[model samples]
Target: MSKYFKKADLILFIIILALSVLGFILLRKPASDNAQIEISIGGEVTEVHNLDTDAEYIIETEHGYNTIQVKSGQVRVISADCPNKDCLNFGAISKEGQIILCLPHKLAVRIIGGEEGLDAVSY
Candidate 1:
Protein backbone atom coordinates (compact mmCIF):
# COMPACT_ATOMS: atom_id res chain seq x y z
CA MET A 1 0.00 0.00 0.00
CA SER A 2 1.03 3.58 -0.54
CA LYS A 3 2.60 5.50 2.38
CA TYR A 4 -0.32 7.96 2.61
CA PHE A 5 -2.90 5.17 2.64
CA LYS A 6 -0.97 3.27 5.36
CA LYS A 7 -0.85 6.37 7.61
CA ALA A 8 -4.58 7.03 7.08
CA ASP A 9 -5.48 3.45 7.98
CA LEU A 10 -3.41 3.59 11.16
CA ILE A 11 -5.03 6.85 12.21
CA LEU A 12 -8.51 5.40 11.57
CA PHE A 13 -7.70 2.28 13.56
CA ILE A 14 -6.43 4.29 16.52
CA ILE A 15 -9.51 6.53 16.45
CA ILE A 16 -11.79 3.53 16.46
CA LEU A 17 -9.98 1.93 19.37
CA ALA A 18 -10.13 5.13 21.39
CA LEU A 19 -13.83 5.52 20.76
CA SER A 20 -14.53 1.93 21.79
CA VAL A 21 -12.66 2.31 25.07
CA LEU A 22 -14.44 5.54 25.84
CA GLY A 23 -17.81 4.02 25.11
CA PHE A 24 -17.13 1.04 27.36
CA ILE A 25 -16.04 3.24 30.22
CA LEU A 26 -18.94 5.65 29.88
CA LEU A 27 -21.55 2.92 29.52
CA ARG A 28 -20.38 0.91 32.49
CA LYS A 29 -22.57 1.06 35.60
CA PRO A 30 -22.38 -0.61 38.98
CA ALA A 31 -24.46 -3.74 39.31
CA SER A 32 -27.41 -3.55 41.68
CA ASP A 33 -29.23 -6.29 43.59
CA ASN A 34 -32.69 -7.41 42.65
CA ALA A 35 -35.34 -4.92 43.73
CA GLN A 36 -37.59 -5.78 46.67
CA ILE A 37 -41.19 -5.98 45.55
CA GLU A 38 -44.01 -4.56 47.66
CA ILE A 39 -47.32 -6.31 47.91
CA SER A 40 -50.49 -4.27 48.36
CA ILE A 41 -53.63 -5.63 49.94
CA GLY A 42 -56.79 -3.75 50.92
CA GLY A 43 -55.13 -0.39 50.30
CA GLU A 44 -52.32 -1.41 52.66
CA VAL A 45 -48.89 -1.91 51.16
CA THR A 46 -46.30 -4.13 52.81
CA GLU A 47 -43.08 -5.85 51.91
CA VAL A 48 -43.17 -9.58 51.37
CA HIS A 49 -40.36 -11.61 52.83
CA ASN A 50 -39.22 -15.23 53.11
CA LEU A 51 -40.77 -15.95 49.76
CA ASP A 52 -40.90 -19.67 49.32
CA THR A 53 -38.80 -20.81 46.46
CA ASP A 54 -41.64 -23.08 45.38
CA ALA A 55 -44.44 -21.38 47.23
CA GLU A 56 -47.77 -20.45 45.66
CA TYR A 57 -50.24 -17.71 46.60
CA ILE A 58 -54.03 -17.64 46.65
CA ILE A 59 -55.87 -14.37 46.11
CA GLU A 60 -59.59 -14.16 46.80
CA THR A 61 -61.86 -11.37 45.67
CA GLU A 62 -65.58 -10.80 45.59
CA HIS A 63 -65.51 -10.99 41.84
CA GLY A 64 -63.36 -14.10 41.73
CA TYR A 65 -60.29 -16.02 42.94
CA ASN A 66 -56.78 -16.28 41.57
CA THR A 67 -53.79 -18.51 42.33
CA ILE A 68 -50.21 -17.39 41.91
CA GLN A 69 -47.00 -19.35 41.99
CA VAL A 70 -43.38 -18.31 42.15
CA LYS A 71 -40.59 -20.06 40.33
CA SER A 72 -37.31 -19.36 38.64
CA GLY A 73 -37.07 -15.84 40.03
CA GLN A 74 -40.48 -14.83 38.71
CA VAL A 75 -44.12 -14.78 39.88
CA ARG A 76 -47.25 -15.63 37.91
CA VAL A 77 -50.93 -16.31 38.38
CA ILE A 78 -51.75 -19.88 37.50
CA SER A 79 -55.52 -20.06 37.89
CA ALA A 80 -58.59 -18.03 38.71
CA ASP A 81 -62.21 -18.48 39.75
CA CYS A 82 -63.49 -15.45 37.91
CA PRO A 83 -65.59 -16.09 34.89
CA ASN A 84 -63.02 -14.59 32.56
CA LYS A 85 -59.89 -15.49 34.56
CA ASP A 86 -58.05 -13.18 32.22
CA CYS A 87 -55.65 -12.11 34.94
CA LEU A 88 -54.61 -15.66 35.67
CA ASN A 89 -53.90 -16.25 32.01
CA PHE A 90 -51.51 -13.30 31.99
CA GLY A 91 -48.68 -15.71 32.72
CA ALA A 92 -45.59 -14.84 34.76
CA ILE A 93 -44.11 -11.41 35.01
CA SER A 94 -40.67 -10.59 36.42
CA LYS A 95 -40.24 -7.09 35.16
CA GLU A 96 -42.02 -3.96 36.27
CA GLY A 97 -45.02 -4.36 33.94
CA GLN A 98 -46.08 -7.72 35.41
CA ILE A 99 -49.05 -7.44 37.79
CA ILE A 100 -51.57 -9.79 39.39
CA LEU A 101 -54.95 -8.29 40.13
CA CYS A 102 -57.94 -9.69 42.01
CA LEU A 103 -60.86 -7.44 41.30
CA PRO A 104 -63.07 -8.87 44.02
CA HIS A 105 -60.63 -8.35 46.87
CA LYS A 106 -59.04 -5.26 45.39
CA LEU A 107 -55.65 -6.89 45.77
CA ALA A 108 -52.62 -6.29 43.58
CA VAL A 109 -49.17 -7.89 43.54
CA ARG A 110 -46.39 -6.04 41.83
CA ILE A 111 -42.64 -5.59 41.88
CA ILE A 112 -41.34 -2.31 43.18
CA GLY A 113 -38.05 -0.76 44.15
CA GLY A 114 -36.10 -2.22 47.06
CA GLU A 115 -36.32 -0.73 50.54
CA GLU A 116 -33.83 2.08 50.28
CA GLY A 117 -34.82 3.81 53.46
CA LEU A 118 -37.72 5.48 51.72
CA ASP A 119 -40.73 6.73 53.62
CA ALA A 120 -43.89 4.63 53.66
CA VAL A 121 -46.20 7.58 52.99
CA SER A 122 -46.06 11.31 52.55
CA TYR A 123 -48.60 13.79 53.83
Candidate 2:
Protein backbone atom coordinates (compact mmCIF):
# COMPACT_ATOMS: atom_id res chain seq x y z
CA MET A 1 0.00 0.00 0.00
CA SER A 2 2.82 2.40 0.89
CA LYS A 3 4.57 1.66 -2.44
CA TYR A 4 1.39 2.44 -4.35
CA PHE A 5 1.06 5.75 -2.51
CA LYS A 6 4.64 6.67 -3.42
CA LYS A 7 3.99 6.03 -7.13
CA ALA A 8 0.83 8.08 -7.00
CA ASP A 9 2.71 10.97 -5.37
CA LEU A 10 5.38 10.88 -8.07
CA ILE A 11 2.78 10.83 -10.82
CA LEU A 12 0.98 13.78 -9.25
CA PHE A 13 4.21 15.75 -9.05
CA ILE A 14 4.96 15.12 -12.71
CA ILE A 15 1.44 16.16 -13.69
CA ILE A 16 1.78 19.37 -11.68
CA LEU A 17 5.14 20.16 -13.29
CA ALA A 18 3.75 19.56 -16.76
CA LEU A 19 0.77 21.79 -16.06
CA SER A 20 3.03 24.53 -14.71
CA VAL A 21 5.13 24.45 -17.85
CA LEU A 22 2.06 24.55 -20.03
CA GLY A 23 0.68 27.49 -18.10
CA PHE A 24 3.93 29.39 -18.54
CA ILE A 25 3.91 28.67 -22.24
CA LEU A 26 0.34 29.85 -22.52
CA LEU A 27 1.16 33.04 -20.67
CA ARG A 28 3.57 34.06 -23.41
CA LYS A 29 1.31 35.07 -26.29
CA PRO A 30 2.77 34.68 -29.77
CA ALA A 31 3.56 37.93 -31.51
CA SER A 32 1.70 38.74 -34.73
CA ASP A 33 2.24 41.74 -37.00
CA ASN A 34 -0.88 41.48 -39.10
CA ALA A 35 -4.09 39.67 -38.17
CA GLN A 36 -7.74 39.48 -39.10
CA ILE A 37 -10.51 40.54 -36.78
CA GLU A 38 -13.68 38.49 -36.40
CA ILE A 39 -16.58 40.30 -34.75
CA SER A 40 -19.79 38.58 -33.83
CA ILE A 41 -23.20 39.77 -32.72
CA GLY A 42 -25.65 37.67 -30.78
CA GLY A 43 -23.46 34.59 -31.24
CA GLU A 44 -23.26 35.05 -35.03
CA VAL A 45 -20.37 36.42 -37.02
CA THR A 46 -21.18 39.88 -38.32
CA GLU A 47 -17.97 41.49 -39.50
CA VAL A 48 -14.34 40.95 -40.40
CA HIS A 49 -11.63 43.58 -40.39
CA ASN A 50 -7.89 43.79 -40.86
CA LEU A 51 -5.37 45.50 -38.62
CA ASP A 52 -3.26 46.83 -41.48
CA THR A 53 -5.67 49.64 -42.17
CA ASP A 54 -6.62 52.55 -39.92
CA ALA A 55 -10.36 52.86 -39.35
CA GLU A 56 -13.14 53.49 -36.91
CA TYR A 57 -16.31 51.43 -36.55
CA ILE A 58 -19.52 51.83 -34.63
CA ILE A 59 -21.65 48.96 -33.42
CA GLU A 60 -25.20 49.79 -32.36
CA THR A 61 -27.88 47.39 -31.26
CA GLU A 62 -31.05 47.48 -29.24
CA HIS A 63 -29.19 46.33 -26.20
CA GLY A 64 -26.32 48.84 -26.35
CA TYR A 65 -23.76 50.66 -28.45
CA ASN A 66 -19.99 50.46 -28.84
CA THR A 67 -17.28 52.25 -30.80
CA ILE A 68 -14.26 50.32 -32.04
CA GLN A 69 -11.13 51.78 -33.53
CA VAL A 70 -8.13 50.30 -35.30
CA LYS A 71 -4.91 52.17 -35.84
CA SER A 72 -1.23 51.52 -36.28
CA GLY A 73 -1.58 47.74 -36.13
CA GLN A 74 -3.84 47.51 -33.09
CA VAL A 75 -7.52 47.48 -32.27
CA ARG A 76 -9.41 48.76 -29.26
CA VAL A 77 -12.81 49.82 -28.03
CA ILE A 78 -12.68 53.55 -27.49
CA SER A 79 -16.18 54.19 -26.26
CA ALA A 80 -19.25 52.22 -25.38
CA ASP A 81 -22.64 52.64 -23.76
CA CYS A 82 -22.48 49.39 -21.84
CA PRO A 83 -23.17 49.78 -18.14
CA ASN A 84 -19.75 48.61 -17.03
CA LYS A 85 -17.72 49.84 -20.00
CA ASP A 86 -15.48 46.81 -19.70
CA CYS A 87 -14.73 46.74 -23.38
CA LEU A 88 -13.47 50.30 -23.47
CA ASN A 89 -11.32 49.70 -20.44
CA PHE A 90 -9.76 46.65 -22.08
CA GLY A 91 -7.45 48.96 -24.08
CA ALA A 92 -5.84 47.74 -27.34
CA ILE A 93 -5.05 44.26 -28.48
CA SER A 94 -2.68 43.35 -31.30
CA LYS A 95 -1.83 39.72 -30.64
CA GLU A 96 -3.59 36.73 -32.10
CA GLY A 97 -6.32 34.96 -30.11
CA GLN A 98 -7.08 38.12 -28.09
CA ILE A 99 -10.75 38.95 -27.68
CA ILE A 100 -12.99 41.80 -26.58
CA LEU A 101 -16.54 41.21 -25.53
CA CYS A 102 -19.49 43.49 -24.83
CA LEU A 103 -21.77 41.28 -22.85
CA PRO A 104 -24.67 43.67 -22.61
CA HIS A 105 -24.94 43.82 -26.39
CA LYS A 106 -23.84 40.25 -26.99
CA LEU A 107 -20.89 41.34 -29.10
CA ALA A 108 -17.62 39.46 -29.39
CA VAL A 109 -14.48 40.61 -31.16
CA ARG A 110 -11.55 38.24 -31.64
CA ILE A 111 -8.22 38.32 -33.42
CA ILE A 112 -7.70 35.54 -35.95
CA GLY A 113 -4.18 34.40 -36.71
CA GLY A 114 -2.69 33.26 -39.99
CA GLU A 115 -1.61 29.87 -38.65
CA GLU A 116 -4.90 28.20 -37.86
CA GLY A 117 -5.44 24.66 -36.76
CA LEU A 118 -7.05 21.97 -38.88
CA ASP A 119 -10.67 22.63 -39.71
CA ALA A 120 -13.41 20.23 -38.85
CA VAL A 121 -13.84 19.26 -42.49
CA SER A 122 -10.16 18.50 -42.83
CA TYR A 123 -10.26 16.31 -39.77
Candidate 3:
Protein backbone atom coordinates (compact mmCIF):
# COMPACT_ATOMS: atom_id res chain seq x y z
CA MET A 1 0.00 0.00 0.00
CA SER A 2 2.85 2.43 0.80
CA LYS A 3 4.44 1.86 -2.60
CA TYR A 4 1.19 2.86 -4.44
CA PHE A 5 0.15 5.66 -2.01
CA LYS A 6 2.61 8.44 -1.12
CA LYS A 7 2.29 11.84 0.64
CA ALA A 8 3.58 13.62 -2.50
CA ASP A 9 0.82 11.98 -4.62
CA LEU A 10 -1.89 13.16 -2.14
CA ILE A 11 -0.51 16.70 -2.17
CA LEU A 12 -0.45 16.84 -5.96
CA PHE A 13 -4.08 15.57 -6.13
CA ILE A 14 -5.22 18.28 -3.72
CA ILE A 15 -3.40 20.94 -5.69
CA ILE A 16 -5.01 19.83 -8.96
CA LEU A 17 -8.47 19.84 -7.37
CA ALA A 18 -8.00 23.34 -5.99
CA LEU A 19 -6.82 24.67 -9.33
CA SER A 20 -9.76 23.12 -11.12
CA VAL A 21 -12.22 24.78 -8.73
CA LEU A 22 -10.50 28.13 -9.07
CA GLY A 23 -10.50 27.95 -12.86
CA PHE A 24 -14.20 27.18 -12.92
CA ILE A 25 -15.04 30.13 -10.69
CA LEU A 26 -12.85 32.54 -12.63
CA LEU A 27 -14.09 31.46 -16.05
CA ARG A 28 -17.78 31.64 -15.14
CA LYS A 29 -19.59 34.79 -16.22
CA PRO A 30 -20.98 37.08 -13.58
CA ALA A 31 -24.45 38.68 -13.61
CA SER A 32 -24.71 42.22 -14.95
CA ASP A 33 -25.77 45.42 -13.15
CA ASN A 34 -28.33 47.98 -14.48
CA ALA A 35 -29.85 45.36 -16.72
CA GLN A 36 -32.92 46.05 -18.80
CA ILE A 37 -35.44 43.86 -20.55
CA GLU A 38 -36.01 44.25 -24.28
CA ILE A 39 -39.24 43.13 -25.82
CA SER A 40 -39.43 42.37 -29.48
CA ILE A 41 -42.17 41.06 -31.70
CA GLY A 42 -41.69 39.90 -35.27
CA GLY A 43 -38.11 41.10 -35.32
CA GLU A 44 -39.15 44.65 -34.43
CA VAL A 45 -37.98 46.42 -31.28
CA THR A 46 -41.18 47.21 -29.42
CA GLU A 47 -40.22 48.34 -25.95
CA VAL A 48 -37.58 48.26 -23.23
CA HIS A 49 -38.02 48.37 -19.47
CA ASN A 50 -35.61 48.79 -16.61
CA LEU A 51 -35.28 45.95 -14.16
CA ASP A 52 -35.01 48.33 -11.23
CA THR A 53 -38.58 49.52 -11.76
CA ASP A 54 -41.50 47.32 -10.77
CA ALA A 55 -44.15 47.19 -13.48
CA GLU A 56 -46.31 44.96 -15.59
CA TYR A 57 -46.58 45.06 -19.36
CA ILE A 58 -48.89 43.28 -21.74
CA ILE A 59 -47.56 42.50 -25.17
CA GLU A 60 -50.24 41.95 -27.78
CA THR A 61 -49.36 40.30 -31.01
CA GLU A 62 -51.43 39.08 -33.91
CA HIS A 63 -51.26 35.54 -32.56
CA GLY A 64 -51.81 36.16 -28.86
CA TYR A 65 -50.78 38.07 -25.76
CA ASN A 66 -48.27 37.76 -22.93
CA THR A 67 -48.10 39.44 -19.53
CA ILE A 68 -44.64 40.36 -18.26
CA GLN A 69 -43.80 41.44 -14.76
CA VAL A 70 -40.71 43.26 -13.58
CA LYS A 71 -40.03 43.38 -9.86
CA SER A 72 -37.15 43.18 -7.42
CA GLY A 73 -34.69 43.64 -10.26
CA GLN A 74 -35.96 40.50 -11.97
CA VAL A 75 -38.27 39.99 -14.93
CA ARG A 76 -40.56 37.10 -15.77
CA VAL A 77 -43.64 36.16 -17.70
CA ILE A 78 -46.40 36.15 -15.16
CA SER A 79 -49.09 34.94 -17.58
CA ALA A 80 -49.65 34.30 -21.23
CA ASP A 81 -52.32 33.19 -23.66
CA CYS A 82 -50.03 30.98 -25.66
CA PRO A 83 -50.83 27.36 -26.11
CA ASN A 84 -47.68 25.84 -24.57
CA LYS A 85 -47.12 28.41 -21.80
CA ASP A 86 -43.42 27.53 -21.79
CA CYS A 87 -42.45 31.13 -21.02
CA LEU A 88 -43.97 30.91 -17.58
CA ASN A 89 -41.69 28.02 -16.68
CA PHE A 90 -38.65 30.20 -17.32
CA GLY A 91 -39.21 31.72 -13.87
CA ALA A 92 -37.27 34.99 -13.60
CA ILE A 93 -34.17 36.30 -15.32
CA SER A 94 -32.01 39.21 -14.16
CA LYS A 95 -28.83 38.38 -16.03
CA GLU A 96 -27.70 39.80 -19.33
CA GLY A 97 -28.35 37.76 -22.50
CA GLN A 98 -31.09 35.77 -20.79
CA ILE A 99 -34.21 35.41 -22.94
CA ILE A 100 -37.75 34.14 -22.76
CA LEU A 101 -39.40 33.30 -26.05
CA CYS A 102 -42.98 32.58 -27.03
CA LEU A 103 -42.65 31.13 -30.47
CA PRO A 104 -46.33 30.75 -31.03
CA HIS A 105 -46.93 34.41 -30.37
CA LYS A 106 -43.76 35.61 -32.03
CA LEU A 107 -42.74 37.32 -28.81
CA ALA A 108 -39.18 37.54 -27.50
CA VAL A 109 -38.20 39.04 -24.16
CA ARG A 110 -34.52 39.32 -23.34
CA ILE A 111 -32.28 41.04 -20.82
CA ILE A 112 -29.65 43.25 -22.38
CA GLY A 113 -27.35 46.29 -22.04
CA GLY A 114 -25.08 45.69 -19.07
CA GLU A 115 -21.62 44.11 -18.73
CA GLU A 116 -21.81 42.22 -22.00
CA GLY A 117 -19.69 39.11 -22.36
CA LEU A 118 -17.99 37.62 -25.40
CA ASP A 119 -20.16 38.20 -28.42
CA ALA A 120 -18.83 35.24 -30.38
CA VAL A 121 -17.67 31.76 -29.43
CA SER A 122 -14.95 29.78 -31.23
CA TYR A 123 -14.64 26.05 -31.15
Candidate 4:
Protein backbone atom coordinates (compact mmCIF):
# COMPACT_ATOMS: atom_id res chain seq x y z
CA MET A 1 0.00 0.00 0.00
CA SER A 2 1.39 3.37 -1.11
CA LYS A 3 0.16 6.92 -0.73
CA TYR A 4 -2.05 6.57 -3.81
CA PHE A 5 -3.00 2.89 -3.41
CA LYS A 6 -4.40 2.13 0.05
CA LYS A 7 -5.72 -1.20 1.36
CA ALA A 8 -9.14 -0.34 0.00
CA ASP A 9 -7.65 0.21 -3.48
CA LEU A 10 -5.89 -3.15 -3.36
CA ILE A 11 -9.05 -4.92 -2.23
CA LEU A 12 -11.09 -3.24 -4.94
CA PHE A 13 -8.52 -4.22 -7.62
CA ILE A 14 -8.56 -7.84 -6.47
CA ILE A 15 -12.36 -7.95 -6.49
CA ILE A 16 -12.52 -6.47 -10.01
CA LEU A 17 -9.94 -8.92 -11.33
CA ALA A 18 -11.83 -11.87 -9.82
CA LEU A 19 -15.09 -10.68 -11.33
CA SER A 20 -13.49 -10.26 -14.76
CA VAL A 21 -12.14 -13.79 -14.75
CA LEU A 22 -15.46 -15.16 -13.57
CA GLY A 23 -17.35 -13.29 -16.27
CA PHE A 24 -15.10 -14.69 -18.98
CA ILE A 25 -15.56 -18.22 -17.72
CA LEU A 26 -19.35 -17.90 -17.52
CA LEU A 27 -19.93 -16.02 -20.79
CA ARG A 28 -17.42 -17.56 -23.20
CA LYS A 29 -18.82 -20.04 -25.67
CA PRO A 30 -17.39 -23.51 -25.40
CA ALA A 31 -16.24 -25.47 -28.45
CA SER A 32 -18.98 -27.81 -29.57
CA ASP A 33 -18.28 -31.40 -30.54
CA ASN A 34 -21.14 -31.42 -33.05
CA ALA A 35 -20.00 -28.32 -34.92
CA GLN A 36 -20.30 -28.05 -38.70
CA ILE A 37 -18.89 -25.97 -41.48
CA GLU A 38 -21.05 -23.80 -43.70
CA ILE A 39 -19.82 -22.55 -47.03
CA SER A 40 -21.26 -19.56 -48.79
CA ILE A 41 -20.72 -18.02 -52.21
CA GLY A 42 -21.99 -14.62 -53.25
CA GLY A 43 -23.68 -14.29 -49.86
CA GLU A 44 -25.80 -17.40 -50.38
CA VAL A 45 -25.16 -20.54 -48.38
CA THR A 46 -23.89 -23.21 -50.77
CA GLU A 47 -22.93 -26.17 -48.62
CA VAL A 48 -22.86 -27.53 -45.11
CA HIS A 49 -20.56 -30.30 -43.94
CA ASN A 50 -20.01 -32.06 -40.66
CA LEU A 51 -16.80 -31.32 -38.82
CA ASP A 52 -16.14 -35.00 -38.26
CA THR A 53 -15.71 -35.56 -42.00
CA ASP A 54 -12.54 -34.89 -43.97
CA ALA A 55 -12.98 -33.49 -47.46
CA GLU A 56 -11.85 -30.97 -50.00
CA TYR A 57 -13.93 -28.66 -52.13
CA ILE A 58 -13.01 -26.49 -55.07
CA ILE A 59 -15.36 -23.57 -55.40
CA GLU A 60 -15.35 -21.77 -58.73
CA THR A 61 -16.90 -18.38 -58.93
CA GLU A 62 -17.21 -16.00 -61.82
CA HIS A 63 -14.22 -14.02 -60.56
CA GLY A 64 -11.93 -16.91 -59.72
CA TYR A 65 -11.52 -20.23 -57.95
CA ASN A 66 -10.68 -21.30 -54.42
CA THR A 67 -9.67 -24.65 -52.99
CA ILE A 68 -10.83 -25.36 -49.44
CA GLN A 69 -10.07 -28.30 -47.22
CA VAL A 70 -11.71 -29.74 -44.15
CA LYS A 71 -9.60 -32.09 -42.08
CA SER A 72 -9.63 -33.38 -38.51
CA GLY A 73 -12.33 -31.02 -37.28
CA GLN A 74 -10.80 -27.93 -38.86
CA VAL A 75 -11.38 -26.11 -42.16
CA ARG A 76 -9.19 -23.77 -44.17
CA VAL A 77 -8.60 -22.36 -47.62
CA ILE A 78 -5.78 -24.37 -49.13
CA SER A 79 -5.35 -22.51 -52.40
CA ALA A 80 -6.96 -19.81 -54.47
CA ASP A 81 -6.56 -18.09 -57.82
CA CYS A 82 -7.39 -14.71 -56.33
CA PRO A 83 -4.96 -11.91 -57.03
CA ASN A 84 -4.18 -10.98 -53.43
CA LYS A 85 -4.09 -14.50 -51.97
CA ASP A 86 -5.07 -13.03 -48.62
CA CYS A 87 -7.62 -15.71 -47.99
CA LEU A 88 -4.95 -18.35 -47.69
CA ASN A 89 -3.37 -16.45 -44.80
CA PHE A 90 -6.49 -16.73 -42.68
CA GLY A 91 -5.44 -20.25 -41.73
CA ALA A 92 -7.72 -22.91 -40.25
CA ILE A 93 -10.80 -22.43 -38.09
CA SER A 94 -12.42 -25.04 -35.84
CA LYS A 95 -14.49 -23.22 -33.26
CA GLU A 96 -18.03 -22.15 -33.85
CA GLY A 97 -18.50 -18.71 -35.43
CA GLN A 98 -15.00 -18.77 -36.93
CA ILE A 99 -14.91 -17.79 -40.60
CA ILE A 100 -12.53 -17.63 -43.53
CA LEU A 101 -13.41 -15.29 -46.35
CA CYS A 102 -12.13 -14.90 -49.90
CA LEU A 103 -13.37 -11.54 -50.98
CA PRO A 104 -12.13 -11.76 -54.53
CA HIS A 105 -14.00 -15.01 -55.13
CA LYS A 106 -16.99 -14.12 -52.97
CA LEU A 107 -16.42 -17.26 -50.95
CA ALA A 108 -16.88 -17.61 -47.20
CA VAL A 109 -16.34 -20.61 -44.96
CA ARG A 110 -17.77 -20.56 -41.48
CA ILE A 111 -17.99 -22.94 -38.52
CA ILE A 112 -21.34 -23.21 -36.76
CA GLY A 113 -22.30 -24.82 -33.49
CA GLY A 114 -24.47 -27.86 -32.82
CA GLU A 115 -27.99 -28.37 -34.08
CA GLU A 116 -30.95 -27.06 -32.13
CA GLY A 117 -32.59 -30.23 -30.92
CA LEU A 118 -35.28 -30.80 -28.36
CA ASP A 119 -34.01 -30.37 -24.84
CA ALA A 120 -35.13 -32.15 -21.68
CA VAL A 121 -37.74 -29.50 -20.99
CA SER A 122 -39.29 -29.89 -24.42
CA TYR A 123 -39.93 -33.60 -24.07
Best by lDDT: 4
Superpose all Cα atoms of candidate 2 onto the true structure and report the RMSD in Å to 1 decimal: 7.4
lDDT of 2 by residue, 1-123 (tens): 484578779899899999988975774355455467778998898888877779988988889788899888788999998899889877898777678888888988887764454353466
lDDT of the candidates, in the order given: 0.61, 0.80, 0.83, 0.84
Candidate 3 lDDT score relative to the true structure? 0.83
Q: Order of candidates by lDDT, top first?
A: 4, 3, 2, 1
Q: Write the per-residue lDDT of candidate 3 for residues 1-123, one digit (tens) a residue.
A: 387988989999999999988876664334456577899998888998877889999998789899999988788999999999999988988776677888898889888765355344322
Stretches of candidate 1 off by over 4 Å are 1-32, 50-52, 61-64, 117-123
Task: Give the runs in model 4 whose Cα sits over 4 Å from its true position.
Answer: 1-30, 118-123
Error of 2 at 51 (Å): 1.3
All candidates: CA RMSD (Å): 11.7, 7.4, 9.9, 6.2
Relative to the true structure, candidate 1 reaches a TM of 0.52
The TM-score that candidate 4 achieves is: 0.70
* TM-score of every prediction relative to native: 0.52, 0.69, 0.66, 0.70
**lDDT per residue (tens digit) for residues 38-57 in model 4:** 98998899988888789998
Worst 10 residues of 1 by lDDT: 28-37
By lDDT, is 3 or 4 better? 4
